[model samples]
Target: MPDPIRDADPTIAAAVESERERQESTLGMIASENHVSEAVLTAQGTALTNKYAEGYPGARYYGGCEHVDEVERTAIERAKSLWGADHVNVQPHSGTQANMGVYFAALEPGETILSLDLTHGGHLSHGHHVNFSGQLYEVEQYEVDPKTGYIDYDALAERARAVDPAMIVSGSSAYPREFDWERIGEIADAVDAFHLADIAHITGLVAAGVHSSPAEHADFVTGSTHKTIRSGRGGIIMCDEAYADDVDSAVFPGSQGGPLMHNVAGKAVGFGEALEPAFEEYASRTVENASALAAVLRDRGLSLVSGGTDKHLVLVDLRESHPDLTGDDAEAALSDVGIVLNKNTVPGETRSPFVTSGIRIGTSALTTRGFGPEEIETVAHHIADVLDAPDDDATLERVSESVDDLCESFPVYG
Candidate 1:
């Protein structure tokens, strides 16, 4: 093959090599990102990418899909076993597309969709005015309790009743605490609305039984395969058998065209890895590391959403502790020292999304790289030190050195 990528286009090859080096050198704390396993990488890089597997397993719109059909079937079976869903569709191109499939299948244009406010941790696809979900549907938003930094089910129920929404969306991008799926299900039942739980951030945790599954409660469940799942990069939808055909049709003809069979193979590989006992430990330690990080930050006077984390990420509200330091400031300072994460908007955000008042840190990638609570605690201290004196060169140098040492010890790709 003469190393096609390197021999043909050295430009892109260099960029890919540079990205690999970047991942190896820095700490990745982005809540929605993870390092997929080598098996997944190999699978995604296979010849499956050349296949155009349009439509479902047996009934495809394209020819020469037998092997792709097997790969996708394996993915769907693994997903069903992992989430206990009656039907699974591993076809949507991304989580946003998966949400679109559900909406297109179930709701009419201009029907009401009530979801968490974007500034309060909800995703843009849930109904941000700029997204198609918002433009096509009547959107209403709910917020976390300002005092407690948790979803207010009472207020949510009240809103559902007052609005009489057609669907209620649950799940978040930055929330730290676990959702009460059962209660949310009851609320949806009370209002006669469909409950669509987008467990994009917590997919692996739910699969590992570390978090509660929405499969039994929500009418439609959507997730990104890459986030906590360590899959290549794609989306999935799960629902009862009654809605299976509609979901499949919506995903194929309505939202997306050919399914990415290479990614589907990647998902199959990753889902198989998750079925092992070690993945359960990885999921558990991910949560434990987040808890340790939360404690370290809170002890240093930074306010954490919900006081602590019960999942893989922690949301730090920097308003009270560092009045002048915005989330953008913290993100840049941390990035300077090779700790990569994101600036996020906190509940009751006073600043714009671009210059928000909080930072969201995650542990799944670190945990995947063999980091435990002790190493994560050390990382947390480095974060606190950097934030304490962001402008100090001496402090930045010290933390930078520490990050280098940690990266050497963990060795993300070794």
Candidate 2:
């Protein structure tokens, strides 16, 4: 190998190298992010990227897709095995695109859609006004119960009845607790609405059986391949065999063009890795680390949404604990010390989305880097220290030093 990138394009090569260093140096606590294995990285950087696989396996519009077909078929079969769905489509570009495929296949234009409100831990693609789903569909929203920080199923059912929506979306980006998918499905059935569970953030947990599978409860399930699964950057849709063709068509001709065969190959590789027994341990440890982090933060007087976490992440509502400190402030303060996470809006948010009342932290990436509860506890202490004394130079310096040591101990790419 001649190292084509470094030889041909030093600028892009430097940027890529710098990004690798950044990931290797910082702790990735963002709920939606993960560091894929080298196998996945290598798979995604293969010659398949040059192929134009415009359609599904064995039936493509273009030529030269036999190997890519095998890759995609492997991905689909592994996905079906992992999620226990009757049908699976591995072509959607991202979780949002997968949702779009489902909506396009199931709903007419201007039909009503009921989903969780954005400030209440829902995604923008779920029904935010700026998203195409909101612009094309009549949108209604549900919220978390303010006192408990959980979805009020009764209220959601009542609202579903009132709205008479065409589809009801269940799933969230930042919710700390598991969903009652059966209850949501029953509500959708009562309202004659299709149920779409976008389990983008919890895909791996569900796959590993740590979280309940929505495959049996919801009409359609959508997830991102990258998030908790570490299956490269892409999306997937699962449904009954009846809607498979519709979903395939919607994903291909309706929403996107040629599929990314390189990513599909990556998905195949990652899915195989997840099929191993070690992956179950990874998923379990991820949740355990999050719980440990949550306990440490709570002991430090930080208020958590839903009181705690059942999955790989925790949502910290800083309103009561640090009235003057915005989530943005904590995020920036922590980032300055190389602790990376994102600001998020809590239920009944009082500030703009840009300046939220909360921060969302996850253990999936750190878990991928072989972190356990003790390491996560130390990271939690570093987080709390940064947030506790954002303006104190000495404290920041001390936390930065600790973060550097932690990153050195658990090298992300190693």
- Cα RMSD, each candidate: 0.9, 0.8
lDDT of 2 at 222: 98
Summarize candidate 2's per-residue lDDT along 1-414 as a digit string, tens digits. 677999999999999999999998999999999989999999999999999989889999998888899999999999988999999999888999999999999999999999999999999999999999999999999999999999999999999989999999999999999999999999999999999999999999999999999987899999999999999799999999999889989998999999999998999999999999999999999999999999999999999999999999999999999999999999999999999999999998999889999999999999999989999999999999888899999999998888889889999767
What is candidate 1's lDDT per residue for 1-414, written digit by digit as tens? 466889989999999989999999999999999999889999999999999888888999889988999999999999999999999999888999999999999999999999999989899999999999999999998899999999999999999999999999999998888999999999999999999999999999999999999888899999999999898698999999999989988998888888889999999999999999999999999999999999999898889988999999999999899989999999999999999999999998999899999999999999999999899999999999998999999999999999999999998779
For each candidate in the order shown, give its overall lDDT on alpha carbons.
Answer: 0.94, 0.94
> Model 2 Cα displacement at 16 (Å)?
0.7
- Clash number for candidate 1: 0
Sequence-dependent TM-score of model 1: 0.99
RMSD of candidate 2 to the truth, in angstroms, is 0.8
The residue ranges of model 2 lying beyond 4 angstroms of the native Cα positions read none
After superposing candidate 1 on the true structure, give the runs of residues whose Cα lies further than 4 Å from its correct spot: none
TM-scores of all models?
Answer: 0.99, 0.99
RMSD of 1: 0.9
